[model samples]
Target: MVLGAQTTEESGAIAVYHSDDLKSWEFTGVLEFDVTNAQPGLSPDLVPRGYMWECPNLISMLDHSDGRTYDVLVYCPQGLAQQDEHYVSSDQCGYIVGRLEGSTFHVTRGFTELDYGFEFYAPQLLSTGDDAITIGWMGLPAQDDNPTVDAEGWVHALTLPRRTTLHNGVLHQVPLFPLPDKPQTQGFGAVATATCEHDETLSLVDAATPRLSTWHAEGKLLIRRHLPTGDETRSVVCAPGEITAIADGCAVEVFSQSFALSVQIFEEWQNWTTETT
Candidate 1:
């Protein structure tokens, strides 16, 4: 793990460490930041605190545009403050952009890799066979103020697991497989031809008690179908082997393996495997 930050008094520095079992940690001392120092464009979503010179997160993902995998580092510097008010919002947060080459890690550009919804901090990489999963604390800087602290006594929650990949020189995230199940209800017209939108929505209901129950959009991918009792939301986006339904939760967004999506709709959940079209 690598860490970089600034002290409350404005002293700036970066460091590295090594751990075999996570239980025992050996500090590898500070890492050298040789890149441009004008404005380190760190992420503002995750780390809210200003004057940060600590806490570092390293993310490893494939730069498919380049074919090889790259490791990116995010850290803080306590002394470096920008003229913008947004940069000084948190004292507990800061960021950086670094890449890993062989065993050596070096800071490269000065832009925040994470540019999306909500605050995502302390991000780490998880190896899942062929993919790298990125997850981090949704709350940072002052963790105490987070609303989840009241319910779970924990100030933050991990961002939904995102399969990270580079597309057309841009980073893209998609939700993992297996999805949350929604209760069946009424509303859908039929499984006939329906117009599809990149951002689509669908619904169904229970025939016995249409008023008693219904299944709302629990994930990004939805299949237009009949009312009451239908199967799971496993229909591919349009065609099989194209962009199939990856049943996660609302956390799923427009994630494509190449650049297209897989879609399919079925009669019912149990018959998902049996449905041909």
Candidate 2:
């Protein structure tokens, strides 16, 4: 079965196809869903609705906590609102845990953002043996203001390959491959065992510009990055969990059971620091 989305900001729909040879395909049905009714008891909701739904991937993942296999849909929807309280972002990468019945994809748990960073979209899943890994573009559409385009003549990068699984009913991703390295930069990787009871912040900081940081406040994980005029930030309300981070030059990736955040820091030196306050 193949599920494809209409990549437009005015409307959203996914086309279902049936393939027997894995090459030739035939149309089966369209899985058009209402966002308001997609989730039953999930928090930190995705845009009440989305206009542009791109790269709709459906995977069968085993719920590790329950030892049961279930279907998971990874969706990239553009055209969400800018900011609502501590949560921000319009181009969103999220997932829905559900089951497919003949022509219908029913929701077990509605859409939840997969990445909580500045740049991450259209993730594609690669199956390995009985497991799977996902990789996404570490950049966004119409966000081409990075200094590297002028300094090095190129821009953007792909995220580290991540291993995915389900715990309880929630999807979790962890870095599967080492961070990619580039010239003139240092390689940094470590498991940050944070006992963040109240608040904690991990950041790529510089004195001159707005910092790129991921922190936990209350029970939400937030990522803040720079924009043309000022800056923008987003959050996923989650409990603290195991976190692992990697850096090679301006590229940084953070991972945990709760969320994954990736960003490209346009700086000569990538200095990441963690603070609990």
Candidate 3:
């Protein structure tokens, strides 16, 4: 079996390894890649030259739409400069869609943010014979001032299990339903319609009125989060679409056709309300 490891020597690389059995391993080398058309002004999202790339996850998906398979390299790149479409926190997680040609991976599309919320990183892809499933951590690096650690003595969380697919050269992730454990009424769920009534605004909040929700606005998806550290907002430029957000006791994952967001919330999710303005 061939596995990928995180390395940073050659521009955010993934070190490849070979293993005949699960127990023994051999250090092969860095996974070589051909960044085809991935450059400044050529690609919409420039491939971040990360100082460090962590948690390398390599997975493949068959785009049934056109009957073509694509390999996705998911990783967390640190020390990225803030951009209009990138994350404010440099440690954002994202993926590259490409095809593996022999020993070299040919990058078809550049880097794209997997999540646009306040906290998301280190996504793992699981091959289940038929589907590519993903789950990620809902915490950022070096920012652990969450109230849960002081109040509940707990911290960090894994995102909802999601099935991934590739459509039109883009990755789509949908949560697997009937999750074993939901927030147990200690959390909340809401859906933001693709398009609200003309000249209307939809707002989602909990008993504490934390801005832990997403809404469709002006051809974009906007997310707001109220954390112990501070309040922040993130937006994605996409065609108007509906969004579903679910928050259990510890974490919240927002779903949309354009992006998926997983964030940690310590606030009470009871008595949730959606307001129009």
Candidate 4:
């Protein structure tokens, strides 16, 4: 079964298609969800995501907890209202864990956001052996004021490939390859580690323009940026004993034991210096 989304703002849903020979295909039906009635006991207070769903991906995986295989559906939703506090991004990507029966998914777990960041969407998943690897667009939807647009004439990039694993009814992601620990000085990529011995701040700056910074203090992690008009920030609550960050050109991705964040730094390319204090 190949899954895709019908782009509609009002009543958007996922379209299902089937193929037997991998060359010929037939349109099946649509996979629709009613947030009002989904997971009444588990997620009774949850609300609908948005008006449209896009970039739909469906895959099956074995649940190590119960020895049952389940299907995971991942998609990006659009047209989310600003007043909706349930989601962080105006356009968000999430997943649903369920079982598929005849082109239909009977969901077992409620919706969960895939990445808690400012620039994560349109994720594509690939299955290798028993693991699922995903790569996402490191950009947002319907935004055109990026600094890279004026400085570099390009505004988007791809995130580093991440390995996804389902454990204890929750999904965890990490970089597919181990990151370098040695300090880099001349390029757009760098790696840094932080500890909880005291409150710490990690900043990447090109001369005076602030690209991005990560602050870890009081069991909370904050990603801060200094824009031309004001400061833009995104935060997550996690007690990270040690945190790792990887920056590539205009994209920065951070990971800890409890959470992860991926953001696109719009600042022009320069020899960024890493500061710790």
The candidate maximizing lDDT is 4
Q: Which stretches of candidate 2 lie over 4 Å from their true place?
A: 1-3, 7-9, 32-49, 82-87, 178-195, 200-210, 226-231, 240-242, 268-277
- lDDT of each residue in 94-122, candidate 4, tens digit only: 77777777766676777666777788889
lDDT value for model 3: 0.66
What does the lDDT read for residue 157 in candidate 4? 82
Compose the digit string of candidate 2's lDDT tens values, residues 17-128: 8888989998987775434345542435533346757887888888888787777778776676655532255477777777777667667677677777778888898766
Residue 111 in candidate 1, Cα distance off native in Å: 1.8
Q: Who is ahead in lDDT, 1 or 3?
A: 3
How much lDDT does candidate 4 score? 0.68
Candidate 1 lDDT tens digits, 1-277: 6666554565655556789998888887655544543234433332233444555666665566657655555454343354432333233233344565544555444444342222345556566543466665555465354323343354444555667565433445555433334321222122112233444432222334321111213322333334235422222222222232232211112223332122122223233232221
RMSD of each: 12.4, 5.8, 5.4, 4.6
- What stretches of model 3 exceed 4 Å from their correct place? 1-11, 37-46, 178-199, 207-210, 227-230, 268-277
**Candidate 3 TM-score, true structure as reference:** 0.80
C-alpha lDDT of residue 242 in model 3: 57
List TM-scores for all candidates, in order.
0.47, 0.78, 0.80, 0.80
Local accuracy of candidate 3 as per-residue lDDT tens digits, 95-193: 777887655778877778888777888888898653588888888878776656655566677888888777766678888665324233432354333
lDDT of each: 0.41, 0.66, 0.66, 0.68
